[model samples]
Target: MALESLDRSPPPFFRVGFAPLTKLFFFSALSVLLMFGDKQLQFTKPIRAGLSTLIMPVQWLVLQPGQVASSVGDYFQNLDQAQKDLQALQLKQLQQSARAQQVEQLLIENQNLRQLLDLKNTVATPSQVAEILFDVPDPYNQRIVIDKGQTKEVVLGSPVIDAGGVIGQVTRVYPLTAEVTLLTDRDQSIPVMNSRTGARNISSGNIMSGTPLIELKFVPASADVKEGDLLTTSGIDGVYPAGLQVARISHIERRVDISFARIHATPLAELKGRHVLVLQPTGIQAASKGKAP
Candidate 1:
């Protein structure tokens, strides 16, 4: 009667009858079998592929709303940013336009003065406006590639100048672009003169503390060169025209122990930013009689 009553009663729902070690052994065996089958038999391939295919649609459906929301949010954010940027660009263009008018007026006056002096007006050569694509990757080269190339009549050895001063020379030409060697590269040299005293010297570039600085070599110790004296190209090389501004004397060091004094010149051109107006060379002969205004 007692056994019958026990059987008739519901078995305890939370009873723990299995031996822990036995259960662990069984699970371990099952896992080992699964891993071995997966590695050696390739038994899971079809199952896994089927499961992947079955769940793919569901997974995509689950993510659809989030994806759509993210896309919409990004589009709106980008639109807002673009609008702000456009307004800022427009304002900058207006300021640049005003400044350009002033520059044009100055150029006109200079042309008139050249004409009156009966001097060869340094003919503005045909030029193509190009954007600097990138800085030269090699630190030793100190160059940049402009978008203008043979298609634009950009030739090698053409002098590249900005509004401030000479930046570099075009050294290599490609089908679609050209490379400009900056004035501050070690291999480059420019014939420069002290604007205040007409003393001629060669400026060579050297890197000091990772910054480009030009050292004026062969300058006489007695040369009247001083800090802040402006230096302009003498144009003796025929590569760079005469009277183009190059740099300003920044430091003059004269040591009795050294035969040559070390002179440093700060480049007039801004090396860190983009510049406008790279003058192309015209093969035309320079008229001998014209004086620069």
Candidate 2:
């Protein structure tokens, strides 16, 4: 009896109306029916539109930063691409301009060569085309290596001429390569004859004076030499073939202090190109059939 009098009933808080699973099933079924009705009858269209309109501002606000970031990224990418394109165009323009200048130079060279044809036949110095390898790394002497050597019948002390004029002489020889000392070297000297006046003088490189510095020495103050006179090889030196184009007198200054006139000349050869011609000195035999250009 005392145990029965003690309250055996659960607290009101524990009182249950329906099980959780039962409530879930019932709500699920109701939701399905509502969805079917909304789909088939358009019953919820107005409601959904109203809810969407109410939340649109919030959605846009949340995504605004990402949209702005995407736009900024695209802007930067386009700007970088434009800069690269501009740089490429500038490089292309420079290359075309260089090619145009080269073409013009080649045309002028062609015309001069045509005029020198008779002179070439008169000298009859057979020559072979050679390509320059690289300049010697010395700062004092202007020397370059060439692809032709003893193997190619390129003789030592042979004159190296280009389309325009004499460039250098082959001083050192190897089986497959040779070294050429340009006329501008301080130690170099060439015997030149004036094309206009037939005056014979020794042309020596004065590397200290000016660009491509060369000067005629021992020319008498009263020598029949004048500015703008073309000089050719005098053939006095057995090493160089006779009548090869050499240098032109740029200026002549007479000094009473010295007997020789200070005659400065510029080289006729545009020695900057890779193409060159090497001729075997008159007595030395060549292996390949040659042409004068």
Candidate 3:
């Protein structure tokens, strides 16, 4: 009875202010009233805007890692695409270079053919066109092979000439090709006449020891030969036609000890021609015509 009376009626510190249900109802009504006033008055807009502004930099910082990863991936993809495009462009450039070389070669060939045609109109003798196939394998002799042969009626000893002048003569004939001995061969000689004066001499090839020159062998020191005088075929040798170009006098040397003059001439024909004209032997043609009824 003493313990119950000590506590039950007891401490002022344990005294109550309000009931728990009453406190809960009063706070709930206060919150509803605040929400209704805020909606009607629109007073919280500036506060909401300030709060959003404060959160924006943090939002950006949070997204930075993902954005950097996407940028790195895109950079690598672009670099790979650029490398592929550069390779493609390089391949195209190589193809264009090859085609351009072929076109330039074709233009040069066409120009040579046109010049040959013009030369053909100027030739008076019966002639035929032939393409030079290749140079002969013998290095000692300056010779070349042509595409015309026995089937083309390319006779042995036929005179071969280029646009500028006489180049060679057909020395060997095959069924489909022929070998031409060029004028610069060591064993070749032609009877040439000076066009300025009527003097004549035999011009032999490679006479100055180791040079591509024709030496007028029998010319006297007192002969009327001058440097730069043009030489043409004398027509006495029935192999070549008269007045066809042969060479030009390049140098003249005379010694009191010798009776003959040492004369050197440069052949006017292009020895490295791609195309040539083969003239019918004048003697053979004349003989055939003579035998004709």
The Cα local distance difference test for each model comes to 0.77, 0.84, 0.87
Which 10 consecutive positions of candidate 3 have the poorest summed lDDT?
A: 1-10
- Give a tens-digit lDDT track for model 3, residues 1-293: 67656655647898887999999999999998988988999788888899999999998999999999999999999999999999999999999999998898778667766777787788777888899899989767888999999999989889999877889789999999999998888889888899999898888888346777788897889899899999999988899998999999999999999999999999999754477888998889899999999
**What tens-digit string does per-residue lDDT give for candidate 2 at 1-293?**
67878987789998888999999999999999999998899999999899999999999999999999999999999999999999999999999999999998788666655534544555578777777899999878889999989889887888888767888888899999999998988888989999898878888887786477678987789889878899999988777877888998998999888887889999988865666778777645333334433
Off by over 4 Å in 2: 1-123, 283-293
Model 3 regions lying over 4 Å from their true place: 1-91, 207-211, 271-273
In model 3, what lDDT does residue 104 have? 87
Using TM-score as the yardstick, the better of models 2 and 3 is 3
Candidate 1 residue spans exceeding 4 A from truth: 1-126, 271-275, 282-293
Estimate, for each residue in 173-286, the C-alpha lDDT of model 1 and write its tens digit.
Answer: 999988998888998898898899998888988775477888898877776778999999887876777787889888889988777788998888754334334555533224
Model 1: lDDT to the true structure: 0.77
- TM-score against native, each model: 0.54, 0.66, 0.70
Q: Which candidate do you rate higher for TM-score, 1 or 3?
A: 3
Question: For candidate 2, what is the TM-score?
Answer: 0.66
